[model samples]
Target chain A: MTFTINAEISQFQGKLYKLSHESTSTKTPMDVNVFVPPSSNSKIPVLVYLSGLTCTPNNATEKSFLQYFATKYGFAVVFPDTSPRGAKIEGEDDSWDFGTGAGFYVDATTDPWSKNYNMYSYVHDELPKALAKEFLQLDFENISITGHSMGGFGALSGFLKNPGKYRSVSAFAPISNPSTCQWGEKNFTNYLGNNKEDWYKYDPTHLIADYKHENQPKILIHQGSKDGFYYKDHQLQPEIFVKAAEESGYKGGVDLRVAEGYDHSYFFISSFIEDHAKHHAKYLGLIE
Target chain B: MTFTINAEISQFQGKLYKLSHESTSTKTPMDVNVFVPPSSNSKIPVLVYLSGLTCTPNNATEKSFLQYFATKYGFAVVFPDTSPRGAKIEGEDDSWDFGTGAGFYVDATTDPWSKNYNMYSYVHDELPKALAKEFLQLDFENISITGHSMGGFGALSGFLKNPGKYRSVSAFAPISNPSTCQWGEKNFTNYLGNNKEDWYKYDPTHLIADYKHENQPKILIHQGSKDGFYYKDHQLQPEIFVKAAEESGYKGGVDLRVAEGYDHSYFFISSFIEDHAKHHAKYLGLIE
Candidate 1:
């Protein structure tokens, strides 16, 4: 994990830094942006944000609605690019919903992609190592993950499969049952081989279908009723996951909020970002 | 006037529409975004927002910190592009600080640009005509103008010269004395041709020096002390205008606020946009 600090600026008493690194998981170069709260007296909780398709690290880190709440609550934020760059590997820059900008946050096992597309390991393993060593003297025990759209899938799959890694988890219109959704089905077949069992490890409902957490961390989910993808084979059908959690005795740590007349747009996110920030702040004990 | 709607979306209980039309003054086509409040009952106060150089109606309408405040206060907002487009005129789009997006809100009188670069007339006359015909129910009598950077120059110049057009005027780091600034000097020389007297109509400081308003509307200005251009050769020097106003026994209708350690960026504007919006709201009696 060799890294270098690209740039740093003081904002609202906190310091935001741009970082670049050479990763072993992705086997390519990557860029990330981080914001550390001014309260340096103690270790702070961390939140990793994953952006949706056709987005780079800049989208969430630059235009995100999380910084205000993060600054107030004294939590740190880590934003990594969706996929590796400069490699120009086969089919990296293909479709808007797949390839380069859309890594789907999964470790690619298929040929041509498996070479440099391993976002799961980059985010789960390499990213934590770099952030923990370089940025904050933060409590790794209280870190959480949250995201939107494809990033939402990343949050659910990342935290559910690696339960002990993240203390809590939440998402803004995530892909709950990816195996059944068009986006999930396409990416899964390409990244995780044809075996159905391999796909279960990355689906939140499947991971929680037979497991129960005695001390389950709080989980929050927001879905937009007017989202275009809700109909047909979309990833966000909260009922499936809710029934699974109930039948499996998942201990009721989940909160699902549906916003009416909202679409898949930044306007929708900005409207309720304050609420999401407050949710993370309260759970992290950064604010009352 | 023939008119067409570009893009529209429902928001804040009203409709926001982007409109386009051919202009009599500017000759070239012009585009503007107008947001009508949630009421069809009575005409509401209008707030015209002029954007800076290198900006179109799109920048302020999409990215500015005004929409939330306008929605909260129940006021209409109209944003006009800084200059005429598709002129195919020479010397346009030459510099970052001048031409194309930098109309300086003045009707050109010289060269190939003189034919289609009449921004002053387009904004003050043609734009108003289109608005009256299209938005017949809007309260034109309670109109106010506010802007930033070059558009600030436009706001101050337009309101002061027109006398009774706007009930209130304000700016965010406007180029106050454009006649004495490099940006103004160069553009005026090219657009108006060596006639200093003709340039007076387009300079806010010059207008204030010659005219006095007994019941002048309140003018508010927010400038960042750390702004790189404040003290530079071509800058909006607030102290000079303050001295002139004091000498003229002007009852301080203009309020100048200098924020410490801030720069000339959207961050600074977003920090204090609510205050400006409230100021206009107070004058319009939209909110108590």
Candidate 2:
């Protein structure tokens, strides 16, 4: 078996399968959780959920409350781990923000990290292919992407870069303009080198500016007003992506909602998960 | 403030307040998380959730998906920690089954444990009083109690002993005949001494046998058939209580639904949470 079933838990009207498989991109075993709705038959649209920094497949799998929505909409939800596990690189486990659990969803171009920190290809390409091959019921073509924080940035940047690849994109408190953020600057400097151009390639704000939508490409985003990362540190500037979208061909396509009293946590994500699910369901043609 | 608000995150018309407070029962600062549902104007009913072994308050707070139901029903939910934390007893953290996270919800009568392991008093009395005094909007008088595994035993034992105290009681994969179960017998011997009578007092099977119904008390329980603890170890003898209920005045009052393909994890609890919430809501008079 290419994928190992670590645990299978029955939840809602579905079963949550915790799986691990050797990844060619990361060159290590990666853990991922896939929730298949109970009544799912034939081909079901996939909704890939990416987690934030200092998270694993379990964080969103346990916290996001996605299974209920998945079961309701008849879509398979996949939770991919944030980064490669047990890489053993120097200073990897030192900080909660930069290394280990914080992959930032970029294919690292620097040494040590470059060898195993290829979460971009792992999540964007390898994971979907692996899942499709393993589970024939999953429709990768009709997939939608959604995430929180760094994972949220992954969804936006991955969606913008690969046009028409995903049916829809949604995020919760995403690091919109990652190139300028402290988290991004440190991670980019370490993983993608000092080249600002490399960082721009992965920045959602930058990507949205050049993105040419076939129709007015609608991207949904819910940011918590009380998010410490957004308000205190000014790390997650969601308005930048909204502004970029306005200037681009996708003008007025972004639906950025600022949720009051919410924070940069799973509580905030779980609150708006149903709305995001509905948004993706509409785009995936699960709902009209 | 004796009770420090560690983090307050907004979710689904509610705010999850992670609080740590000085405990009079446990004699240790205890951590708790309370979910105050949105749009609550008048004093609303409360649901106190007790987690199982090797769990913190965050387990159910994150995974149980109770907040949605609480918000829907206009009720507040409180998730108390499994046990007194950081007690630092000699053999406290030695085993996953006892000590540390597994306080077993007992007011210990032995040795070092007796000093800090008074979880029964902490959860049933002090915690509720503290929460009621602290949050004006919470009506502890109208509170329902529910738990899973060891905490489920807590709910049954607590509810049975304190007649007319709670509006209702429910459990998921609870150790019904804990006095006979190894997990129960071991913890009982350690906490309540070697007296079998002392252990029986805390056992639901024994309690239900002698329980005097006030207008016919009803208790809802959902036990998973695939639960390893129930099948393999025989640690959770739910049938014993059901049999006892059949002989007692609480006959047909104990609704024990054996769910298929579900385990003893939060997944099982979350799967039936809506049903449990509705069950609680009916007794709490939040629903018709």
Candidate 3:
């Protein structure tokens, strides 16, 4: 469970560490970035940011500006890789949206991917426990999760599935209804197989409505109105998930905002990441 | 010249334009990124960011938080390429520090490079004039200049040479005393035909003392203590420039800040970029 420190970069008023460690969930070496803000006495709260398809941990760490506000509000941000690299499975690197960078954060029950593509358990279980063992300054109990695109769907699905695990969750242009969209159907059919039951468990639109928890989970979502993937390709269906959350005992808990002229790029994430940071800050008890 | 619009991405309620145009100075197809902040009534002020060695316009455009502050302060940001690309001269792509990406922002008097490497004229005169001709909403008269590493030296030299051209000047880990440094000696000898006198004209440490302007040039510079390139290699001689500036009647104008635990990466640049942005914004009349 010992993680290797690849590089430690000083950012904002804190330190960003790039770590590589063997994972139990995925059965492969995983790379992750953790940024700890400058705090003197108290243990820092945590924020987990999952990236979209064709992205590693470096994407959000460099461009998202999450660390900027994290340093301001006092929290540690953990950026986990999208998928296990160097898996070397056939057709793994075939499609940009299907395999390789696109793990879809699902524990595959299907073929060759099943051996190494357990990003769901890796992100939620192994990674968190391993990180807790390494960083003593981090308070895992006061952690919030947020991500963009596929990772956004991952955040919502993870939040809904594991009630009380995360303090709060938010997303930027997440694939809300994955079971129906082009990206979702392709990924779910391939990763989870033909079983619609397994797909339903990982889908935010389905999970939010079918949540077994008595307490409704709160969520924050930002959708770029000018996003091509969302509008033209219909890749991101944030409206579907928002409606589901509203109908399923979460009428006022979901904060879905549509930013005009903004796209699905990190520019959109960096623009409104301050709002998401503040939202988590309130939940993590960093500010009153 | 009629510039080809490569990309126009929406960021922070503004637009980042990726433009390509044939440069008159360099005689090559040059690429530059211009960021325009959301403006309603008045024309926007501009900041020309010169990037370090082995960098295109993309490095600063992606990593540096210049745009974050540019959007906040209601100022435009122009990111110019380091050197002319695909200039198939002999040994042009051989060395990382000499040819290709490392133009050192100098107008070369030497043979092969003399034909294409005229970054001095390109950055100081041509780019601004071209940008002004293209962007009608930008107030070119209110433009300031700034850069990092080699680009820092370029910024200081450019600011010093063209008196009253730029409203303000700043740098992040600039090669202040380039004539004395290894990087400067190699570049100057190669580009300026071994003339030490020509080297002095471009050296910030030399130029600050010999500046002909009656009005003292105020400058802001940030240096990282942990930067091995600065401390170990002695590439950035900021203290030497500071001494020269003080001795030559620009006593209180030079603000050289040394940040602790910071490195030479954009992490260091993004950390204190807000201060630089505020400095330029004040001179640009965006804030009181």
In candidate 2 chain B, where is summed lDDT lowest over 10 consecutive residues?
Answer: B209-218
Docking class of 2: high
Decoy 1 TM-score against native: 0.87
DockQ (CA atoms), all models: 0.25, 0.80, 0.78
lDDT against the true structure, each candidate: 0.78, 0.90, 0.90
At residue A278, give the lDDT of candidate 3.
96
lDDT of 2 by residue, A1-288 (tens): 689999988888688999999999998899999999976468899999999999999988878888988998889999999988888888989999988899999999999899999999999999999999989878898898999999999999899888889988999999999899899999999999998999999999998888876734478999899888999998889998898888876843889999988888888898999999999889888899
Candidate 1 vs 3: which has more DockQ: 3
- Give a tens-digit lDDT track for model 1, residues A96-195: 7778787888888888788888999999888888778765476666788888888888987888778677766788788888888888888888888889
| Fnat of candidate 3 | 0.73
The most accurate candidate by DockQ is 2
TM-score of 2: 0.95
RMSD of each: 3.4, 1.9, 1.4
For model 2, residues B1-288, the per-residue Cα lDDT tens digits are 567999888888888999999999988899999999985457789999999999999999999999999998888999999988888789999989999999999899999799999999999999999988889888898989999999899999888888878888999999899889899988999999999999888898998788785735578999998999998999998889888888886843788899988998878988899998998888888888
